[model samples]
Target: MNFPTKLKKLREEKKLKQQDVADKLGIARTTYASYEQGKREPDHATLVKIADFFGVSLDFLLRDENEDFQDKIFEDEAKRILKDPKTFLAARDGEITPEILDAALEIITEQLKEGRKKKSD
Candidate 1:
């Protein structure tokens, strides 16, 4: 949710050790650990370097996931569901349950994130 959490998550997702990332970024492992531990923050340049290393925008590191970008994902998903005749009719007839909808959205979001990560890789 926050920068430190995101940083640790990104590293874990890449299957890299903290030391590996620190070495790649030319920083001491302890310094990188401090960043991930939320005991310290990186300066702007280092933040940019981290973003570049992860192939993500600074905005992704700095902003909350539940912001506009998340809203856009939901909006786009809703539009897609509306455009599909089967889903549209199901929704109109109240055939789709809320649990089903939530599960669908969660799967879609995960798939989208994976696709984006693959693209970056």
Candidate 2:
């Protein structure tokens, strides 16, 4: 996602009102709204503040908005499934359906992101 859309999403994901972020950034509500609307961009310092406030790296917040990023998992996460009896059976045979695998992947992804966030903090 682009900066504008991502900014809006991050705010919503945090359940923060625009004014809440504005207050935190010490900026006007209108200015923050403009950033989300793509009408204005935050300067370098403000951008860094936004990144810090959201607990995300500046690169993560400013990458190409149009880039298509597919879901990725760590090699260890894949190995984890292979080592688990439930998944080992499925991997060796056809015991586990694709739905189960997908659900496992999603759960693992959430766990990994949470772990990284906590470690960063």
Candidate 3:
């Protein structure tokens, strides 16, 4: 896909509107819309900012035929999470509360139980 298409997809995946991205990038909504429509391209600095905001690499944003970019991006994110488990956990709800941790553990335990029951059946 082209840069504009990729940008639009990424922004949508993050549940952000054009205005949200524009505000984050400190640009106008019209400018961001132009980017999504391929009417205008952001400069190198803005490209870097966009990529950083999306937690993706510059190549992922620019390359048309780079099909493995998604895998690479996920792998990088996984490594980052593994490197700092607490930070990753905290990012889920914007803060690492004991209630959140307990809830996560409860969900995991329930899933394990369900899996075991399925296996037995």
Q: Give the count of colliding residue pairs in each prediction.
A: 0, 0, 0
Could you tell me the C-alpha RMSD of candidate 2 in Å?
13.8
Best by TM-score: 3
| lDDT score, candidate 1 | 0.71
* Ranked candidates, highest TM-score first: 3, 2, 1
lDDT of each: 0.71, 0.70, 0.73
Which candidate model has the greater TM-score, 2 or 3?
A: 3
Query: Can you write out model 2's per-residue Cα lDDT over 1-121, one digit (the tens) per residue?
Result: 8889888977885678999999999999999999999999999999988975664557767885554322222232244454575654543343444544675677778889999999999
Best by lDDT: 3
Residue by residue across 24-101, what tens digits does model 1's lDDT show? 889999999999999999999999889756645677788766554433333433444544747554433534435436
lDDT for each residue of candidate 3 in 1-121, tens digit (9 for 90 to 100): 7899889988886678899899989999999999999999999999998986775668878988746545545544454444566656454334344443554555567879999999999
Candidates sorted on lDDT, descending:
3, 1, 2
Worst 10 residues of 2 by lDDT: 68-77
Q: Clash number for model 1? A: 0
